[model samples]
Target: MNPLYQIFVDPFVQMAGAPDLFAQTIWEGFVGGMLYALIALGYVLIFKASGVFNFAQGIMMVFAALTLVGLHEMGVHAYIALLLTLGVMYLLAVGVERAVLRPLVNQPDIILFMATFGLTYLLIGAGELVFGGNPKTMIAKELGLPSGGIDFNILGGLVSLQRIDIAAAVIASILVAGLAAFFQYTRVGRALRAVADDHQAALSVGISLNEIWVVVWFAAGVVALATGVMWGARSNVSFALQIVALKALPVLILGGFTSVPGAIVGGLVVGIGEKLGEFYWGPLLGGGIESWLAYVIALAFLLFRPHGLFGEKIIERI
Candidate 1:
């Protein structure tokens, strides 16, 4: 077998020989991509309203998941723990607006960006202080998530689909749709759009910047919680999970920071690309290429598009 042929053609031949495996791989990638989209959506919400590229979103997801799981461990009911976690996130939004954004209003974008990094460190310290820096199991059974998976026979092979992954996909779809509806039709949504367009102009038109900031942060928090739950169900919730947020960097680059639809599409592209590349071509490179493949894909797209696939093109007037 030619080395190049083994690297390039063998994977496809294997895929062609086992259609079921290909389908399974695709499904796995799709689920992974949806999770990436969820995280990217959090970034979009914050960026749109405040022009702050929040670096703390990954921490927020872990923190939220930890809070819920911690509460349940302390003997609180699952649903009650969930409600309490939401309350915590809401309060956190209010606190951030008052303590961070309000004081830093009108500052340079770099300053605001730095503030989120500070916030990230603060959350990390606080979460560790409270939660003891331990990995906790997600209360999937308590939360009523489906366990086990369904198996299907295709192309003379068994393709097993995890019920939880299916649920994650469905929940992600619903959340994205819900957010779309909220942004398109609600008065607050219109104000949010205005704020995203121009903060000073939004204030001139009677939109309260403070209120908008709080709402945006709160919305991002809610997104973080949902992401946390889904992710925790898939694996143990730990500080290490915060690394997943880094995956969103390529996603944002691929989708553009401001477009929600771009997040979804970019995530799927990155997810599927990484999986296929890892499964097929990974061994040639001695494996473990999944970590960086998505970035390569994003960089490839960046060379051509610059702003991203769905990102708005900027026209500079001299």
Candidate 2:
């Protein structure tokens, strides 16, 4: 009856004896992880185009969800409302390009980062003013999304799984795959990569930096829409949900800022690691340790591998 053994060893032993619970835990992790990657990808899109980190991605998710709900309330059918939302995002992108990126071309990285912070607050104010700062139920069934449960019997026990979560996993996987392929194979994707490498170089080659920024930001808007819908489908759409998007920071840390596959792998690692850690090792530190476990992992990773699990290190010679 060692207290140390009881805290760590016994819990894992208990987990070993419960296969269904383990599967359920893993399922939860995968779903949460994918959502993190989705948000991180939004950041990646912005960073790739402008070489600046965007802090407003979380609010973009909130704004996208709010727009969908607002459109739905205004008598637009879900499909048309979604299309309209895309248009809204598209307009927002174009406006940002014309007003922000065009003016800030060749600005310092810190200035661009500050600009994104301003954009974040602008979005928050806009979303609150427009959406009323209330949590709204997701248009799950109305949007033709599925809802049900799966039953698994293991170790003489039962585990229930949500069908919506399954759909989220598949959709997330397809999204990541499509994005990877697009970036790897398409002309626009190559343009995006070139832009990421060097804005001046791309511009020298007759590439329009403003145009690429607009396109990339619009693409991020599309991602925000998709992420918002799935997220809203799981819970009420609100500013609070935007807070969850902050989890992408840790994912970014774990996966490296510039690596797409790193985002996915890092998200999954953080998601699963935090969940498992909370369940097994968290109690030893009291309880409810899930709130900041990802950060702790990120800090540890930073100490050991500052570039992140998949990030590349660059040496700049002055």
Candidate 3:
């Protein structure tokens, strides 16, 4: 057996030999991919309304999780904490509208983007100051989420999948579907699409830019909350998971910035592609290649389709 043949071709043969591994990997990929798409949802909403790239979306996810956990530590019941977090998010939406969006209403787009970068630092500091900068275990039992595993037995071996992972996948599907329907069928959604095209034209039509901005950012906060919940269920809730939200940036790159459907599709592609590449080719690169593989795919997409899979081509006549 030639070493090159074994190194290069063996995995394909092995994949055919063990279909179960492939199935398991794809399942894991889909769940993780949906989580990434959830974060992308927040980015898309904010970008669509005000054209500000909300760099704080990930930190918002962290802040939401910290709000939930901090309430629990204060002896509040989980359900109450959950409801209170919703209220906090609403207040956050209002504050952002009054404090940030209002003053910067007519500023250049780059300035608005920088403002969000500042908001990111603000959220990080606030979350750490309130939550003590330590990882906290998700109160899965307290929340009454499922805590069982499903087992697949084949050839005298068992591979088990957690029920909570299944639940998270189901919830993500619902969120994505609901978001798509809103943007397609609802009045506010239509207004958001209008604003995404041209803020001045939207305003000319009597669309309230401030109102829409608040609504869109609140929608983003809801997405952040839902995402924090599911990811928290998987591991300890911490600020670190927010960095994983940053992974959604490449997803946004592959998907059009304003496309809900593209987020779903691009997230699945990145998730499954990275997992497959790492499993099959990681040893060749000394392993740990999955960390940067998503960016590699995004770079390839940039070279081929800078506007992304669903983005419209920008035609500038100079």
Candidate 4:
């Protein structure tokens, strides 16, 4: 057997020999991609409204999860803790709008982007100070999320699917649908789109920038909380989960900065591509390829479609 054949042909042969494993791998990839899409959705919400590329979205997720767990640890009920967390996120939105966006209005986009970096650090410090630097188990049982998975026998092998993963997928789908509806039909959503298109024009029509900023940030925060809960249920809640933000970057790039549908499609591509690359071709390159394979997929797509799969094409006249 030649090295090329071993690298390319062997994995397919293995998959043919065991179809169950391939199905399992694909299921895992889809779940991972769905989680990544949740994070990307948060980014889309913030970017659509304020034009700020929120660097803190991942930290916000970690912070939201830590707050929920920490509150539970301090004798609060799970449902109560959840509500309190929502209140905290709302306050956070208010504070950010008053202290950050208000003062920085009319600044360059780069400055706003930098401000989110500062916000990231602030969230990290606050989360650590309040929750300590320890991993905490998510209160999945308390939250009524499914505990274990079901196994299926196929092609003389077994494929296991976690119920939580299914729930995550369903929930993500609902969130996406709900957001699309809100953006398409609601008055506030119309106002948000208007602001996204032209800030000065929106203001001239009596739209309050501060009010819109607070609303948009709060919406992003709600998304962060939902993402944190779903992700924490799959794994332990910790500051380290912030790394998902990096994985989601390729999804954002592949989808387009301002597109919700693009995020979902991009996430699925990155997720499935990363897993398949790691499973089939990773051994040829000595493994651990999943970490960077997504970027390769994003870069490949970008070479052909620079603005992303669903990004709005721009035209300029010089």
RMSD of 1: 1.0
**Candidate achieving the largest TM-score:** 1
Give the CA lDDT, 0 to 100, for residue 311 in model 2. Answer: 82
In model 4, which residue pairs have backbone atoms overlapping below 3 Å?
none
Model 3 local distance difference test score: 0.86
> Which pairs of residues collide in candidate 3?
none
**Candidate 4 RMSD to the real structure:** 1.3
lDDT of 2 by residue, 4-111 (tens): 798758988978888778878887888888888888888877876787788878888889989999989989998898899999999999988887778987789899
Question: Candidate 1, overall lDDT?
Answer: 0.93
Deviation of model 1 at 89, angstroms:
0.5
Error of 3 at 155 (Å): 8.3
**What value does the lDDT take at residue 2 in candidate 2?**
85
Q: Over the stretch 1-318, how does candidate 1's per-residue lDDT look in tens digits?
A: 799899768999999998988998898999999999999999999998899999999999999999999999999999999999999999999999999999998899899999999999999999999989989999999998998999998778999999999999999999999999999999999999999998889999899999989899988998999999999999989999999889988999999988999999998998888888988789889999999999999999999999999998988999
Per-candidate TM equals 0.98, 0.96, 0.94, 0.96
Q: What is residue 297's positional error in candidate 2, in angstroms?
A: 0.7
What's the distance in Å from true for residue 111, model 3?
2.0
